[model samples]
Target: MQDAVYGVVSNYYQNKVKGNHEVGLIAVVHTFGSDLKWNPHIHALFTEGEIDKNNKWFKKISHIPYKYLRKSWQKLLLDIIKKNFTDIRTKRLINKLYKTHNEGFYVNAERDIINIKQASKYIGRYLARPAIAEYRITN
Candidate 1:
């Protein structure tokens, strides 16, 4: 699952975010949400832009259409799952999900980070946090 997510995201950035270029990024997989549910997701921190084949870094365009990202992500994720699991029931379920959700899966690219220090702090707190913090658990 982790590999699939990373591969899809990298491909999305390379092909969609910046054509003919690759983007550097770090993806942290979070298997559980704050409520301690078995909800898997990824937190990826991408470079402000992309690096072309010429080894030149280019800042990404200001606008990245959320709709495109969502649709692309949904397609890629479903493809990955279908390729890995070939069972009849699984394939049916995936197809049903695809037909059910026209907008695709949820892929949100949060606000940009202007400060490196602040970004680092935020990443550390989010990616390194425990699955279920004792403080967050009520008695």
Candidate 2:
């Protein structure tokens, strides 16, 4: 799951950011939401740019193309799933998902990181956050 997140972002950045294969990023998988609901998802914090062949960081990226990435992610996920599970039923479901979700899977990036404070807050909340908050536990 982690690799897939990195792969998609790396591929997109490489293609869009002038063929730079290197992408600086940190991806975290959060398996549960507040209230202890079983919700699994990945969050990534990536640099807008990276070092090019000239060994210079090209920090020109401003926005991400979520629409296109969604399609790529969907394909990647389905392929991964298909490879892991070869059962006919699973295959059928995979095919169904592909056909149904034309725009591909929905992956969300932290859009509110407008400043260092907000960014740090997000990192604290997601990246380094414990499975259960200290206050949530009681003896």
The candidate that achieves the highest TM-score relative to the unseen native structure: 2
Per-residue lDDT of model 1, residues 36-87, tens digit only: 8898888877675778889988876544567876776688788888898999
RMSD of candidate 1 to the truth, in angstroms, is: 2.7
- Give TM per candidate: 0.81, 0.84
Model 2 Cα shift for residue 22 (angstroms): 0.8
lDDT of 2 by residue, 1-139 (tens): 8788878878877776666448777788889888688988788887777876688877767777788779988988888999999999999999999899989998775463568897787777788877798998898
Each model's total of backbone clashes: 0, 0
Off by over 4 Å in 2: 112-114
Task: Return the top candidate by lDDT.
Answer: 2
Clashing pairs in 2: none
